[model samples]
Target: MQSTASTPELYLAELPEERQHIMTALRDVIRENLPAGFEEVMSYGMLGYAVPHTLYPAGYHCDPKQPLPFMSIASQKRHIAVYHMGMYADEKLLDWFKEEYSKHSNTKLDMGKSCIRFKKPEQVPLALIGELASKMTPQEWVQVYESQIKR
Candidate 1:
């Protein structure tokens, strides 16, 4: 569920106890695998990784005031979600993510253009998430985003 919690600690505290461990594990995977130059912050009311303005200055193309978001993890009304912006640009990555997720997970992967949805921690494929997380450096993300914008 979308929360009023401003910080990651508060966000974690507000989640159902049963959900906390899963969320923490997913957050850990993102944190551990994310490249340098990406900052973790609350964005779109979720735990988000973004390209900070100090580094990019361009901000997000859609909203210059906001950082360029790479990914976000949040508890939604019915499911947990990880929004991976990279997949929208790289269809191969999206396909590979789905294939790997299916190979590793017992649960069906319910995904949209950029959002992967799952009911529980077990539904998530942590290894695939880590591989995706590790693949994009902030510079690569910027290039990908810029390319999309130019098109």
Candidate 2:
């Protein structure tokens, strides 16, 4: 469901304590490594990293009214979830991410096509997450996203 939240602070205020802590840590990592053109906003009832219209006016193909979503983090009922749009379109990145995750994290990788789930912040591979987030500039991500839309 799309969030009625218009700000990050509002999103954090609604999360439970444990979820707040986890999301806080992950948010720190994201804020630190997020590229220049990406902006953090609340979308789909979660924290979203997006390409503002100024950067990619076409917006997300699914909903042109919204900005293009690069990634999102949410506190699900069962676990913390990370949605990485990059891996969905890039097989090489997916393979590399999985291999790197296995090498770095002792916790079993619980992942969907693009969503990575973990219960605790300690289970996350901080370096891997940072590296992945910083892998592409806004322009590069737009190219990758557009390529998929074309096919």
Candidate 3:
């Protein structure tokens, strides 16, 4: 995966064939589920969706040119990771998501603080992933970032 400095289109074009397939599928799923404020961009060597600053000036703090990312999709060496912003401060929701994932996914879903890692596309539960993606609204994402700083 290329760095965020790479243009989103270039990054997509440069992805390995396998990773490109995974990224494209993930991108379509995410785009279909996320709200209107979410715009695709390259961040941390992956595709990420963020809110435009015109909607919230304070959304871009560290980088005035970039908006606040709520979710991201990365191509790791052995797997793809779906990064969720909800884990930043919402432990209860995070735990609930983990439990829900495990309950329905038969223990195949692997997750960390915010990233859900999986090697094969078949291993991913599309419906459950969609549910998880829907949890963090733009307002909830801003709250998570603020609470993260407090901690």
TM-score of each: 0.94, 0.93, 0.82
Per-residue lDDT over 8-115 for candidate 2, one digit per residue giving the tens place of the 0 to 100 score: 888887787766776788888988898899999888888989999999999988899899999998888777888989899889999989889988899889999889
Top lDDT model: 1
Measured with C-alpha atoms, the lDDT of residue 20 in candidate 1 is 91
lDDT-based ranking: 1, 2, 3
lDDT of 3 by residue, 90-124 (tens): 88778788788876676466777778898776676
lDDT-wise, the better of 1 and 2 is 1
lDDT of 1: 0.88
Q: What lDDT does candidate 2 reach at residue 73?
A: 88
Query: Considering only N, C-alpha and C atoms within 3 Å, which residue pairs clash in candidate 2?
Result: 3-45
Please say which candidate is ahead in lDDT: 1 or 3: 1
lDDT at 105, model 3: 71
RMSD of each: 1.2, 1.4, 2.4
- Choose 2 or 3, whichever is better by TM-score: 2
Model 3 misplaced stretches (Cα beyond 4 Å): 3-9, 60-64
Which consecutive 10 residues in model 2 have the weakest lDDT in total? Answer: 1-10
Candidate 1 lDDT tens digits, 1-151: 6677889889998998878988899899988999999999888789999999988899998889999999999988788899999998987888778777867888767888899898766787777788889988989999999999999
For TM-score, candidate 1 versus 3, the one ahead is 1
